[model samples]
Target: MVHNYVMRLNNLQRKIREEELDAYLVTAQDSIYYLTGATYDTAERPFFVVIYPDSPPDLVVPELERARMKKAQGIRVVQSYFDYPAAPGGNWYDKINALVGGISKLGVEPSIPAEISSKLWARDIVTYSLVSELRLIKTDDEIESIRQVARYADKGMALLVKNMYNGVSAVELLALSRQLQKEIVKAGDYDPLDNEFITVGRPAPQSAQPCSVPDYGDRLRRGPLSLVCTLRLAGYAAECARTVFLGPPSGSDAELFHHMETAREIAFSMIKPGTPCAEIDQATRDYFESQGLSEYILHRTGHGFGVGSHEAPWLSAGSKDVLEKNMVISIEPALYLRDTGGFRHSDTVLVTEDGYEPLTTYPATLAALTLKDRRPLKSLKGGFVRRAAGA
Candidate 1:
């Protein structure tokens, strides 16, 4: 892990030099974790890590978190403040400027606090991120971590299916599945960094918007339920989602489900190195339209996934990124019918030298997802089991 952080920091420093940046400043916690192997809940506190071409990387954290942040690798200097609104010597901005000495220009990330940004010495400050594109290509160690968490996500989905039943509310289902997934995460020595959204109802009308945890009151009777789960371990993330039916699916539901699955297959076939990222998205959408489901497409086919839930090399209709080996992306081909629910299963994939490799191993077949309520069993005096009243 220490070696990985050092190598990534070096790569980012090289990019800073290429962009002619005097120094690069970062505030995003995930980006910091990517470069320093430190994970924490920043929670309104101002935390910063700055990198330079010649000087060692420096970190400024809250005094309360100083001991924990100190354990991270690749950071040459650590400065701490007692809290926010500290005096002159206690401010992170002041310490950062002192470390830079006389650098003329500074590159800052998107989430830099206004309090600190206004006080920087650089007159020609630019916006740049050291971890965005660099995170697209996963190292061997990163791939392993992603795969491990991906497996945990798969288990959570299977548990959801086993527990799904008629008249189950969205909140009830999500709570149960979360409990199950949490056990697996702890057993694997991992932690939950974000919420898992499970929507069990008719397709949402707003398809272009972000997916959120469904309202607890909406009951899922006998139709389709969409489940999306993301798991993270050691600062790496893996996500998988699927739409399952409570009972046997209707003919229309079956058709659209298979169509979306077919679109995912098409996207997978076009994931070889050198293929245009937009081309794969266009191909998937083309296939969906060919099957007469064009109106249901809410957004792009998928987005990149790694330390963060979404990242670069987006598979959309207008993307300019070219597919490169080792780039990790999600292949999600989904559509939302006005009356019916959404249909989709986002799979994390890795572009390879020749083709792509699937990191998510969950089964998305109709049979696998068509869940029925479990029947109770009764035992007789001879210890023989028989179907209960409901069965």
Candidate 2:
């Protein structure tokens, strides 16, 4: 009752009916959960959601998940089969075909199991890859769930800031973030980590940015100015980094951090409904130019975040999608020097009828707590992060 899987079916049905499709094969884990409330992750034994727009959503799961699928209340029909480990003679494709036959138009997530999809294609059928566009704007429930995740993120960021000072390594801070309270993130029954996700950096040198395992080293120190972007909690990735001064930002460090924060402010200020994503990007770049820090603008403004950390409706140099209500995003226009480090302001934002809602409220603003006092790293609640309303 809490999660109306029927709503997803309703929307998908409208699309399918318009195109006169019989069924849509959904292989993506998120898509399955969004449509059936039945989630499982066993790549060896494939599971899929075969949604018949006209009828109820059916699930094709393995024998092991049969009882669980049968007990599931949302999905009305479910078909179980023996999978890869011992499904030699069993033809699961045939079952899939039976459900998909006559469905002239089939919709699938962009990232599907290539092998399975290739064999499942029909000559007379229209297979649509509705990803970025389909997920462009989130529903009210989706928005609320993400907002809940942001609450934990905001709390986590606050904890991180409280411990900010000399001698704290990036690795330590990263570890500390993992140790903060994850109450709000897990509150809505959405498990983001166990779900398909990603967390990486956009380091000064792009190569070091996306490394799954980075030798955080002494990359964070009391010098230059560094920004620490971390994916701290579930269902959300806090892609914000700061301009830390080696021993309290001063001179060039202070100057750079100030300009970078302004750049981010410029971008955040431009976040309104109907604004072009690319134009928002240009606004940030222009701020950097105004400060004569163009060369330090390392990455494309920012990107979309949801079930996957990096998604569509990206805020890049040439994106064309207009910002819309309930579309959550993070705008981190930054400037970083090679060994010196960087400065960035990133908040998980929800686009509103007016401006945007900042999910995390660490308040890394230049004037807020640039060179604040630092006590020893204290034990934070929930071991991961805290709640953030807005800042």
Candidate 3:
């Protein structure tokens, strides 16, 4: 999709004028990508986009990346420094100072590293999240891009579910994820660097730890297995996750899953324009509390996602953000049992005028997610036919 970077820049410039700032400095990699569509490794070296009130944006990069920065959208002035820790006059700091020497008030993102912000040569270095605030409301192209990525996320989740068996290991899942990444790159004709596909498989007790990474040799067993698929395409991201039973779920497991789904739906029903983010989270929390399962809650209900997997408009109790139309977010209300497993399903949702629309279309019903002890021949044949047909 072709993005109107000129219009985005104009919006930022307009915001800059409103704040009475001469220029705004963007140092975050994702923020820079949101503005200029430039992607690069940001190891140690400082990369910046300087936006003036009247003229076009200026980019500062390492000399090695000069050619690529020159090709970036909405950028006309490309300045480069020799390298990190270069001679007194040939460093990033010097280059930035030269560009903003005449400006009295400079705007910088609040998340900028203190080391860099401290050395900037502005008399008034204001902290502002202009780009982040702008990103909260996505444009038409961005919403379309996110929808496309969500489709791949659903496909990846289905592939993982299809490959599940008695003793599948996380390493095997990783290999499958890489294969899926290749398929998406070929099918969508996207740059390999711009696409990321990751799948995490946690079975039974291990799944209780939401943030722990499964060992390479960890294998799936006969219990609740949490499968997480996160995909990024063309700088947009979507996530799909489900807890499937390797065998027939126990009564307690089914009960927990039902409660989790109920809580998720309650939150979903509350999503709409002008709804306070905290209210949605509180309603979910209230449901879990009523079920006496509040102790199992480990994280917030959800958060917004686009260029960055987790952005603003967070669905947490303390968040002041409000739901708005065109904003894309995830709805994941989970319950983690100590020795059992996690019960959760996450879907990327778009807030609309009336309610919300789920972008990820993977099946989330318990009956659909339950797996047999062995892979069915019919399932294998179906997968083969689908692959043969180039689906």
Ranking by TM-score: 3, 1, 2
lDDT of 1 by residue, 90-160 (tens): 76666767866477878888767777778888767888756687887888888777777677677767666
Estimate, for each residue in 1-391, the C-alpha lDDT of model 3 and write its tens digit.
7788788899999999999999999999988988988788888898999999989989999999999777678897899999998999999999999998678999999899998897888888999989989999988899999998898888889888877877766665655677777786677657655668888888788888877788776778777898999988888899999999987899989999899889988998999999999999999999999989999999999999899998988999999999999999999999998888888899999999889999998999899999876556534543553444343
lDDT score of model 3? 0.87
Distance from true position, residue 100, model 2, in Å? 2.1
Pairwise lDDT winner, candidates 1 and 2: 1
What candidate 2 gets wrong by more than 4 Å, as runs, is 69-73, 85-88, 101-103, 125-134, 181-212, 216-219, 224-241, 289-292, 371-391
TM-score quality measure for candidate 1: 0.86
**Residue pairs that clash (backbone atoms under 3 angstroms), model 3:** none
Cα deviation of 276 in candidate 3 (Å)? 0.6
lDDT winner among the candidates? 3
Q: What C-alpha lDDT do the candidate models reach, one value each?
A: 0.73, 0.62, 0.87
Candidate 1: stretches off by over 4 Å = 1-3, 87-89, 110-116, 177-210, 375-391
TM-score, every prediction: 0.86, 0.80, 0.94
Per-residue lDDT for 188 in model 2? 50
Superior by lDDT: candidate 1 or candidate 3: 3
Q: Positional deviation of 272 in candidate 1, in angstroms?
A: 1.1
Model 3 is weakest, by summed lDDT over 10 consecutive residues, at 382-391
